[model samples]
Target: MAASRTIEDIINSDTDNEGDFEGFSSESDISVCSDLSDNDSESESEVDQPRNDEWTKRFTPITVNDFTCESGTKLPDSFDVNSASPLDYFWLLFSMELFVEIARNTNRYAKWRMDQTGTVDPYWTETTPNEIRAFIGMEIIMGINQLPDTMMYWSKNPLIGNAGIQDIMTANRYQKVRQYFHVSDREKEPARGHRDYDRLYKVRPILDHVTVSFLLNYNVGRELAVDEAMIRYSGKLSFRQYMPAKPIKRGIKVWMACDSNSSYLSRFQVYLGRSAVGVEHGLGFNVVSGLTNNIHGTYRHVYFDNFFTSIPLLEHLYENGLYGCGTVRVNRRGFPTELKKPKEIKNRGESMVMQKGDSNLIATVWKDKRLVHHLSTLNQPDDIQPAQRRVGPTVLQLQQPASVKSYNKYMGGVDQHDQLRMNYTVGRNSKKWWRYLFWFLVNCSIVNAFIMYKETSKRPRNKKRYTHIDFRIELAQGLISGYTGRKRKASEIDCIPLVDSQNVSGHINGKLSGPKGRCRYHLKTLGVRRETVYGCTVCRVHLCRDGCHARFHNL
Candidate 1:
């Protein structure tokens, strides 16, 4: 057999897990989740085991191999990661062609607005792909060098100003690009009651484009996790969720699949309220199935939380080539009464396990600080792994199912992606709701691209790795490489890439632009430093003209 398979052929799925493949007329998209789990069947259960009021605890561990799945990352049949650049990796999820569409639609919107209101001087000019690219680059830079306000990047206040962004494109031009940005024609939008209407219609192009790219670009690992990610939005919308327990209390919910080890996002679906959320099949079941559609028979371990776990779902996964394990709710249907008893495991670290009447599924109830219930097709009920926990400044040793350990290890993929994105977020407060999603996708592009770079990187082992900030700065530089939106600054005439605080090399300049700052050479040479108005024009580091300027640039 080949070492890897083309993603599509990897599954070679004859039919969906639910039923025979019935080709639908609507695009898996058309501004929606790509899935084939739609079944009109009244029940999602294959066979609901008879309710057993009587319970018996089993101590013997299940040594079942009937439900084992393929392990490890599903390497692609062939990918050119060794020769790919950051921009090349980035194009996997987003591209200049997409930006060209944006530019065209923005001009259309600008014209529409101009015609609606009798305006004399419309400052809007048709933006080019490179200008749009520069705009995105500026956004990336701003994400890294965050100030109190967006205008600070263009401010004359030397204390907190960035000439690099201003040199690429004027702040007015950047704001104008943002102002008129459009992903789809407003005139072509379907009405609310129209069957073809999509709530995500405004940004459908990006949503569809990037969603496809995520799957097309990278092959995922064996341990993939599906979870919901919140994009913080306090704006009023029909489908916005408010889970008080989540760190982001209110925002749009997005279902995502990420590699357990790398946290590389492979698929994402924006929630569109009850209309898009299914009722016939369980929400958890539909969500897991839909997200993992392209990898059905690949035998990867899928980890999730209580929200998406159910007995029928695990059974369904077992029947297919996949395996599943997650912390499940006690109330969810399918756990035999044996595993649900509150006092089944009386002591901390003690656990009770039960198999569903010779079936492969095993439900484990372990008591720690409190009882933790887990359902798995991957691990036997009594397969335990020793772990340690701290309580009141004391570390206590305890035993847990290997599945619980796996769940803890693999379930943070989405969270990891979230952490990477939040560190340097782009975008400002906008009245337009779609801009948030757009910014989100841009951030995702950088993150996924960086991950791809790392995975496919051919750099020597001794070479220093690119930190997220370094990657963003270089990415911004590459994006603005061909920008001609504004006239070049005198300092920018022969300047190196505009790096934040980390200058590569540049000459000393003989002029002052704004307020004074600490002299670079004085800090290093004199063991004491003082602020001076004069600085190097290229690198923009302030230095004393008399003594520090020559010494600093020379070094």
Candidate 2:
């Protein structure tokens, strides 16, 4: 008798209201499913599902169905990476538009914060895109060389001081930016209990823009994987999820899809689960369908784990010309009962296969160390492949179905993505829950950029290759250099490298070969740091020549 609420509605409301969970939507490029029923009473798919007795008559022995989709790298054919900088690769995902939007919203929020507290801070000012880049550079370096406290990056103590990060901005400046960093306007957020009050409204703008960038910059491969990832937040929040089995026990749960070959994050959506789903075809079905909506009709095969695999989901994928394969649970409504615990499949490496009537849907039962059940729409029923199982120093061949083979191969993409992201993460302590997601996005940007850099460049420079740390360092240097170039352009010295990379050796104490300006390397007689011109024709700096130029270069 009550009106059926949608997935968004269920998430927005903290309490479980009685309604059929249906119709879903995202920004653009994602299609919504309409009026999907929650129970057999109204669900057409469940109503038509074959019973155990019916499955007995419809089930047939293994049969081959020759079907496969063309899979390849998706990229802009004309785009060249030969001369591209590391920053260029990073900018592919974190663009000028995104930066500008973030800066605008940050400034807006700063004003709101001040207005809400009715106080003004003396040191805070509107942040510029260049400053934001430098802030990000600082964050990147911080990830690479973690200290106990953020302020330690600019610590005066010898044990913790980092000149590389300090040169970008003063510690005070960096902390100020972090204090007010934001992405969406608070003034416009809908009031509680309103129809449009979204829990994720604060960071929705950032997600929308970055997701568009991610989708447009890379092409989807043939094998796509969907899985859940934790964002590592133990803070108090309504939707924060706790998975005891996950390495990260508590955080926001996000559903993600990644390209199987390269672990490229294709799409992601945050899970808003404050309460349980009171409907069939619950969370997993909606998540898979929404995440894969962009790839429908292209014959792409999607692989997931048992949580998302179901009879209705497989049928939905098959009907849309997409293929689905995943480890399945025997207890799901339409699963054949005979194969639930078949005693004959006791030997390791043995597998049983059956077709669902005459359709492309095939169910496989493989016996390894344990019995595994799989359902697939694209793999042939009888296509068995060889697998190697290790027993001490000896290895033996094990029989495997093609669907099992593919699942084993592609199911790790999401995990791989998480692993790569966890390394050198830009995560830090934050009072705002959204900031954790922000840092996660930053880590995603780094991982995605590095992947593109690895795939596209013959070598970034110097006939040399870059490791992950190398990429992060270079990216930080580029942002700092780029920012410095913007600040001063009055003379021959366009920019100078960070102190650690500078040619501090041998170049110092050289004869003054260039025009004269004040010396740059010495303290003034009054103990003040010199701002006098330190001109060097050789170094290309427009500084006034002082007698100390010789002494300055040596130090």
Best candidate (score: TM-score) = 1
Q: Backbone collision count in every prediction?
A: 0, 14
Tens-place lDDT digits, model 1, residues 1-555 = 111224355345432243343322222211222343744331332233322232234332333333133322232456465655577667656866787888788888888777777784366788877888888888888788888788888887667888777777777877788888787877678999999998898988787777766765667777888999998899888888999998999888899999888998888889877765347648888899878777656567899999999987886776665789999999886566666776547988888777665444678888878888898877766678998989899999999887778889999999999899899998787867788888998899889988877766674443375688877887888888857577667365443333234322546454556556888888888878788766777677777756566667567
Residue 531 displacement in candidate 1 (angstroms): 30
Q: In model 1, which runs have C-alpha deviations exceeding 4 angstroms?
A: 1-83, 276-278, 460-463, 488-555
Clashing pairs in 1: none
| TM-score per candidate | 0.76, 0.75
Best by lDDT: 1
